[model samples]
Target: MDAAARQAVNLNVLRRHDPAISAIVDTSSHVVVYNFDSATETWKKVGIEGTMFLFRKESLNRYGIFVMNRLSTDNHNEELNSEMEIQVMGDYVIYRTLDDKVVGLWIYEASDRARIAKELEKWVVAARQMGAQCLQQSWIQFDVFSRHLAVFIICALAEDLLQSVDTDRVPSSVSATCMLARFRPDPPVSAHWFLKV
Candidate 1:
């Protein structure tokens, strides 16, 4: 398939599965994932050492499930453990354990949190519109991935825009501090939430 067609298919696959994945793509271009061992549940030396179809397709939509699956008992062997790492230069996130069962997750930045909000709203609205109370109820318990609440401020902005903005009006200084506080290891996934797709 042509690049565009492949991209479209990749997006559709991810979107149908989950929207959170797309959010990761908005902020950065690449991420890194780390995997763990199954038997001892410690850091394993084996890793996937390859790219995932989702990353190759270049869709942001599947990031959430991609992450969830890598961290959970989904699509991967139960013994597998995963984490995400971002490679700003490489434009992809590699998910793997020390063992090197690397599964590459394409990275995106900007929309991480917003995507979560949009998907949450979309699901809520769809449920209400369709009169699916059961589904709606189920969704209520789901927690948003905590990674997205952060704001990334350019270093130049820290020196320029933040200094000029009034503390009361927006508190640019405070905002910048908050952003830095939320910053995780650029890729955002640790052994805790990182997973393979």
Candidate 2:
């Protein structure tokens, strides 16, 4: 099969069976985080190590909002320190201090489960030896495997809708709304609603 055909098949498989395998298979082009220096107002490239997720930019922003909310709610009274360790569960990442205090927690869907698990294990070992705190504490750089995943899914759905239409005219908003509903479903109003909202 041609490359496009193969990609279509792969995307179908991912959408149907494993939505978590969004990370780029090749590691060389993974996303890298850069640290912003408040003093100089400059962004410096931070070394990239461990597993990174390939999240749609919008999804990444949404995830950041969730993380910020968790940080505020969970660690409001706790002191921020440099001796924290990070652990990755199925879809959640947890942070704890050396004294075994939970400091932060965030939910992230992995691009590739097996690769992420392996990388998380390696990072745990490294964090144990070198500590988890960095120069800039608040910034996180996620490796985006492909920014096109969301767009591709939407476009594919749009094409299908167009093909099924009896006339040439179709409302763009209708397709957009359908796409949003398909990808992001509504959730109950609660503390964890940030993940879905």
The predictions' CA RMSDs to the true structure, in order, are 22.3, 23.0
Model 2, span 1-197: residue lDDT tens: 99667656644543343353342232212332333455786545434323232222123221111111111222111222235444555544445645664422222336543454454445446444433333222122111212334555666777676667764364655664465556542332443322221
- In model 2, the number of clashes is 4
TM-score result, candidate 1: 0.23
Stretches > 4 Å off in candidate 2: 1-86, 112-121, 127-197
Tens digits of per-residue lDDT, candidate 1, 104-184, equal: 433344354334334433433443444454445444422233333222234444546656867588754567557544552
Clashes of each: 52, 4
- Pairs that collide in candidate 2 are 21-111, 22-111, 23-111, 31-143
- List ranges where model 1 is wrong by over 4 Å: 19-34, 37-42, 45-50, 53-73, 76-197
Q: Candidates' TM-scores? A: 0.23, 0.21
**Deviation in Å, model 1, residue 173 alpha carbon:** 49
